[model samples]
Target: MPKTTETTLEINLSALTHNYSYLKSKLESNTNFLAVVKAFAYGSDSVAVAKHLEALGVDYFAVAYTSEGFVLREAGIKTPILVLHPQPTNFKTLIDHCLEPSIYSFKVLDEFISTASHCKQQDYPIHLKFNTGLNRLGFRASDCNNIVEKLKATAAVKAKSIFSHLAASEDLNEKEFTLHQISTFRAVAKNLESLIGYKPWLHMCNTSGVIHYPEAHFDMVRCGIGLYGFGNSANEDQNLNPVASLKSVISQIHKIKPNETVGYNRAFMAEGHQKTATIPIGHADGISRQYGNKQGFVFIKGLKAPIIGNVCMDMIMVDVTNIECSEGDEVIIFDGIHKASTLAESANTISYEILTAISQRVKRKFLK
Candidate 1:
């Protein structure tokens, strides 16, 4: 494909493969690696990421919802996909596409079983999600009795895996809490196993869990941010190579005198005479409004260019007085050299948010 007109997201398949291999090395041979490709593979092209992972022999793929799984299925991804959050309304479509749903609550379980049985489906694959301690979604430990009863009644729905989300696996200070969650999940999984007469695959660790708590890496590990190269901790962060780099070219330049105002609402007033460059990217392109008025910056010709004013829908101006760049010259938003983590720090967020928020409008180029 030709180079796009504005900004672009370059996905390095080689880095992805390396990260996968590295994470796999950290686990036991029999342990499965579930790549979380939801939100366009964390905002970097889910198809490309999933395809590369499938080729590399990833055991499974996971998404937050049923529609994301459909995208992978339609893209010719034959690997099994786990829908972390399944809605009752899309049970039919999910079953039709051979996608597995993660049933969290008793209500969810009852509804999914009812829907599947009504469709005359048998041994329909599904994952049971236990809340553990996140308190977001999933079955509470108190709901265990009801869950056991539900499982015995719903023979058509096969529980293929039991999983939970970790709330703070990266914070060493939260080690005790993390262990508590794991222990609780283990009990829940064991109880469900007893009722079902068999143990489904158990997974609880996300990227941080893979690094911080190896003992919790039971049957599988669902890696999201780690696979994309931003480990949640500093030690882990130092080890992974970021795979996605964002780049945009200068569309125009202007000289601003002292006291001059720039961008929407005149958010930035020049403190002194300065040169500014406009890049064809904005909130619509995933550069959030939080980066407006010198709060965030981008790298241009090896120098940092602070954002000048309100981030417009289609454009953002950066103070380029000190940077040696001209119109059409490329600037780095986030890359191996600049680092997505650094950009995220400037934006007062994490790399996960920045990476996942990158709009699909930006062209993606994959390089091995």
Candidate 2:
């Protein structure tokens, strides 16, 4: 791999496969696995990730929007693709590409039914999302009867699966709440099954849910961040290999005397003499302004270099006074050593946000 001056997100396909295998080991032999490749596979190259997972025999792939699934389909992905949030306007495109939709509400169900009928589609597979506790998206428990009635009323669509989201699966303190959610989902699934005369695959476990609530694995499991090498907790994260490494070169170095300021808005003033290095990536590349003002740090020659000032659109300045580094030397923003979770914590966010926020402008290199 040739080195480049610009920032690059290096994706290790081998680590991705390792993560998948490790997560699969947590499930029963018969249980199915659904890989969430939404948000460009959490901002690491969706098609590449999806293709690799597909090759590894992922039972299903899910994306946040219809267009995301369409992109996968266009790339010759034959595995089943689920559109987690489907819009009424894209129903035609969804069917045209053989993509499934998660019908979470009455409006979505009604709209999809109408669209499927217009397209003359028979037994179109669609998943029903229930609001067990998250209360974000999903039909209420009361909506079960209505959902069953709607499905019985038309053969245009079929219930491919029934699922829900666990709001706090990772928090051990929220174990009771997670259990309640699992119980609620179970009851909802039973009700829908009795009404429909059959059970579609029932699933409600994300990565954290899979690790903490193995009993709630249901008929299928959805693994998102876990596949990207994070387990949501330190103990669990230890077993997974981080797949992406954000790397760049120190473009320039500056020596500032005492009382001199650095970066825009004078965000950092040298307490004494200081050495700083400017890297080629900044807010535009998804290193948010929230990471500035010394809130975040990067690794240079295996030493810490705290961010010194406001993150600019195309660059950032870091105090490298202690680190013995030079221009063109490698800088590690977040990798195995400098975990994305650590950076996210400093930025008052989560690893998911940090990973997905990495802009498309940053080139992605896949390592097989």
| Best model number under TM-score | 2
lDDT by residue for model 1 (153-242), tens: 866888789889999999989999999999999888888787768889999999889988999999999999999998887778778889
> What is the C-alpha lDDT profile of model 2 across 211-302, one tens digit per residue?
88899998899999999999999999999999999999999999999999999999899999999999999999999999999899899988
Residue 135: error of model 2 in Å? Answer: 0.7
Worst 10 residues of 2 by lDDT: 1-10
Instruction: Report the Cα lDDT for residue 365, model 1.
Output: 85
Query: TM per model?
Result: 0.97, 0.98
TM-score of 2: 0.98
Superposed by TM-score, candidate 1 places the C-alpha of residue 135 at a distance from the truth, in angstroms, of 0.3
